[model samples]
Target: MGPDIRTQSLTKPVTVAEYLFTRIHQLGIRSIHGLPGDFNLIALDYIPKTGLKWVGSVNELNAAYAADGYARCLGIGALITTFGVGELSALNGVAGAYSEHVPVIHIVGCPSTVSQRNGMLLHHTLGNGDFNVFSKMSSEVAVDVARLNKPSEIADQIDHALHECWVRSRPVYIMLPTDMVTKKVEGARLADLIDLNEAPNDPEREDYVVDVVLKYLHAAKSPVILVDACAIRHRVVEEVRALVAKTKIPAFVTPMGKGAVDETSPEYGGVYAGSGSQDAVRERVESADLVLSVGALKSDFNTAGFSYHTSQLNSIDFHSTHCTVRYSEYPGVTMRGVLRKVAERVDLKKLTRVESPAVKNEVKKNYEDSKTITQAWFWPRVGEYLQEGDIVVTETGTSNFGIWETRFPSGVTGVTQVFWGSIGWSVGATQGAALAAKDLGTTKRTVLFVGDGSFQLSCQEVSTMIKHGLDVTIFLIYNEGFTIERWIHGMEAEYNDIAKWKYTEVPEVFGPSPKQVKKFIIKTKEELEKLLKDKQFNAAKGLQFVELWMEKEDAPRALKLTAEMSAKHNVRLED
Candidate 1:
């Protein structure tokens, strides 16, 4: 059904750029995101020949963000940027990908090998002879780094970097020199798919780990499965669902793991974020005698500021590279394989099944009867507006905390940068997410909730979305400043404030024709309610922008709690 590497020509001599792009294209990268610079312009010419679309972004950082979102949806994505300045500018986005475990191939076009060898000063360089500084900086964030200087090793370097990206599910860096772009190389390696498979582990060790886990699982009267962000990053969502189904165990998800499993399943409990968790969810997970944690990521934000109370001795942790049962750890036990084995070997009849507690919907009422929009009332209302198959993108501040209160319907994908905490990620991410949804032939709308302060950082990417006529609905929360920062340390500091813009006029200013885009401003609940019911708004055709006016001091309850915890941690003295 797919391209067969065995039948492909083995002796053909293809340009190095062709080989590299062809390998990437074969890996399902339909679109590559980046801005064109002089060093990379020649390499860009080969993109079309490989049947991959060049999504020219407005800036390097936005390009990287777009690629990150695309990779999350498509499993693997690529970004091409030119030397020093371009790569450095994109580092923050790559760091976020590293933190979140997104598989993005970052290809940088550098100066010719001769230029580097002669130590010639280049415009994009640091003006000194050192060209390795940038690559060294990239090494800190990337899982693997390869600089292709010799034509002979080009295929191996590219293949290794690409394979590392797929197997580790993290961003990898590859530097392509300008002169090396078109250098002819042997195309024999193209006959076989890159070996992205995980190496086999010790069978005895895996069996011992599974037996130890089963021992605890069978002896406990109450056992709950906790699915976190790593399940999605390691490509084990199906395995997690299968395990839950086979064992009939009650399951709960962390904030980062929100959409990995079908939230609408009967065994699915709500989010578990320690103190920030819903009452019933916190009780169900924390009180369990044995907890099976699959790909759990316990970041401070995800765990309500490191407030998790679960005992490590009672928890069995399953990771991408290893598995841990109580105090014993089994290295090289792949989570996918181990989870499958556990699901197959787990006897549902011998284990006790407890019904998940009913999720409570506590609606906060405005006793003062104020007409203003509030986070408490707004987030719950958003739950009612969401439909199946919608991809929800929440920004780092208020939107992130707000969405935690809203339960997603089945087939919904929630994208956020909690661990990395990048502010402007959602704006650029929406572009790639919408494109990915279109490429997958899904009839889903991309819904983005971003703060006004965060939106300004990468707001120009909306023009890219409009250029491609993407179906995106943007809900911009206009709170007059960085409300999250204010809650954290500076309550009324001037540094926390931002310049005000006519948020509704953004689309028109960005070159979108009036009829091609829709804009709305809602200061009260009635307007928001009326807008949600509007058929044109729900269709999400073209680019839809809604500016929601709210108070600067107002924040979601969860944010308040976490902010206080963060402040306490910041002031703590060393022992």
Candidate 2:
């Protein structure tokens, strides 16, 4: 990661692509995901040279999604695409990262500067001779856009963009012209790594906010801590855990915050998603005397179609940019500093401790004897099969909502597009998560639960995963249609139906594995249980695929509740 070395001494100059990738390598990004094209082929050559692995994806869109998932696991991720068509295809995935506050660097390669300035008709252009349209579109979703047009300012632009991407935990765009890829830059610049530390909160404001939070926290008779997604994105999981433990109050998680808190804790309450939650969880959260909201991103789906009844007056919200103690807001006071201070300064003796409600992932016996798998039984059953070090990835449809019922082990990591609710995300995300887990050597397995309908969009990434020999387990649920959409809209419409492809043929159609790929089809709960207990399957020595046949109309209780609420809201008259 240091400056270049020659025969006798360190070199002084290097290519722009070399400098860029070297900086990315220092950020702990071992793998770069993207598709190669005429424009980016030259840049791809520099990736391996910088001691980074190049993951050639099936398409630009999957590459972007893979980058997002990789960022969630490894803290930051990067992807490269070529020119207008490639960049346009990756926009939706990048927008999801922006919506969820994931840090991803999107680098797009374009035609030469001479070609752009002369308004030459490029193959991917719209025939209007405009080269800035795609970049302008990306600006909407990216926190910062860095164009490497000037040789002198390129280093600063790249540094600033990467800095913003990390500190803000959102996507950033970097445009590299073909000619700029080979342009010379000072090698000495690589010696000094870019500053990626988060900005500190103002001491005066932080202390004041902490005092206000303590004032309310000490007076409450029955207070509970509510955790959400931004706690993970802002790198404050430790602080959140510290406060929860030191305060000895019951802590709960939202759907998007499943992996933020340890479920094995004695004070850990079940998930709270308004009307979608279980009766006990809903009553416990809504009836709390004071709610310590940690990094809450209250999207409609996350809140069960905005059914949450907790008023702003009784809640104290902690955000990365501001801290809200009831009606008073303190700007420049972040949660990381204030949470730690409160945990250190507060007197737990004066606080009331409410016992966490009894919560367990117990499978109901009603469907225990059923022939076919129902969502009611399947999700809870999965809890028994999941291991501690597993990374569970879910699609935006059934799996996202269904996972609310599956109690995970202590060290598990959950990945889902809850806020964005984009279909077919789990397939690509599973691949990225597998690679990230493998890279970090921190997880035992990466598994995905995707619907048969949503699996059609980015299924080709399974080939990319196979090529990399990623040890992934895929659970393809065959239900004949988008059951989630049926719950929200037309139930019997043909538009909701999907082709019943031979899903077991994926390994044969895609590249044959470096290691043997195993496939299975289970129609009954007995078969699924047998497969789950199989030692070979649990080992996850290689890629494994399972096709589970289930009833179409049935869904998880959480999705059923939220979809019905969403259906009524969809037809509401304009206010």
Candidate 3:
């Protein structure tokens, strides 16, 4: 990072690249995630100069996933890749971010304007000299795309794109041409702050929405609070928490809304995924006369194959842009203001004091206590090991479903791509979330529970984590094959099996020093318990890898139910 740009406030001129990176740094992003290509090589130099470290990934897709985790942890994240092939490679990750409502600024380095104007054949192009095709593909997923072809319009476009990304909580595309990287931009604008706060909700409309919410809330004899993924994504956790606390109603979280509500709270109920929910949780949520849903995103995975039994007429849903009171939708009303107002105005004395059952994670003894580690016992056992402020990244398959059974400590930020359902995302995300935690000057631990099969897809990113010297704890679930798939469709299919690796040897292969990497091969319940209680193991040192061996056919109870419903939904009706 070149000599501290925050105090300089350049009044004269700076390279457009400097201005861009400086603006990014000002957002408090200490790192930029991506790989360097020839087209973007020069632009990479500006990153460190603007006081941002360059966290290069093994591949563009991993970079995108890392950026997604980073964004979820720190509010804003960015990744840079060379044009055409590089950006195209990251499309799936970008699409994942879009689906989950994450704010990731994707900066793509394109061929020179001259090459585009002359239709010159480029190496990364489609071989047809159409430089715009890749950007066109990106536009489908991006909330905004700012093309930096014109020098005069560059600053405005970048600022506008950043605004949209932050406000909408979605990915934005910025096209940086090779030639324009060195061009001058007005640097005085850097003196001004990027207005990140959402535009205030309209006074009358906000009041009306709040009033409607209170009317239904006050009248309902049995009302419950249902928090979802968008509550975290839309940056309304504080507001949601306030409402939950003020109302003192029973609070529950959806599958994707793992850490949205502090599980330790007395009001906090267990994870509610329709029929997949625990008996007590399902009964509480489905029987509620009125459900106050905050920032809800009802994807199939979140709802357990659209099995949500709560009637829309009795549900009041909230979102960043809109809120729905029963069947009547209030478009353009922001949830932030409405939630806050409702929390402030609601009568605490009127709230029904329903006793919320404590959702605790205790090692189960469903089967007679045995040496072998079973899925039933392992999930809750791992949950007992979790600490407050842990960034938990669960992979798409079994790990995702198993997490529902594991209650969390307060302040844990969950990183799950259920809607996207991208395999191997947790590997890169663990790196990013740990990096983000470090960037924020917090002692928060980045804990990952990933499957062996999912780990193989982007395992190279672990090398990047060790290279950066991030202190991370990985609980690599060493099942022999795709256990979740076997539970769903194929019990004995060869396609479900993955090649086994010497998992304990991973630290030596990816990490630099034997002393820095701590590895454990845990095959039994007693061994896991012993390790979990060890003083040194609990310290959260650098690159601690613990492999828990489990039978391939076993899975969490929630997954067994979900996989069955999913299998039924997948059958093509004879039409």
Q: What overall lDDT goes with each candidate model?
A: 0.88, 0.89, 0.88
TM-score of each: 0.96, 0.97, 0.97
- What candidate 3 gets wrong by more than 4 Å, as runs, is 1-11, 365-367, 572-575
lDDT of 1: 0.88
lDDT of 2 by residue, 121-226 (tens): 8898887878888999999999999989877778788889999999999999999999999877778878898998878887887888888899999999889999
Candidate 1: misplaced stretches above 4 Å?
A: 1-10, 360-369
Candidate 3 on 1-575: residue-level lDDT in tens? 68635335445678889989988988888999999898899999888899999998989999999999999999989999999888988889999999999999999999999999999977988888788888889999999999899877788888889989999999999999999898777788889978988999899999999999999888888899999889999999999888888777999999888898989999998999999998899999899999999878888778887788999999999999898999999889989999999999998777665767679885664443678888888788778888988889999988899999888988888889889998899898889889999999998888889999999899888898899988898999998888778877988999998999988787688747976789999998888889999988888878899888988788988888988888888895877
Worst 10 residues of 3 by lDDT: 3-12
lDDT of 3 at 362: 57
Candidate 1, residue 319: lDDT: 95
Clashes of each: 0, 0, 0
RMSD of each: 3.8, 3.1, 3.4
List where candidate 2 sits over 4 angstroms from the true fold.
1-11, 364-366
Candidate 3: pairs in clash = none
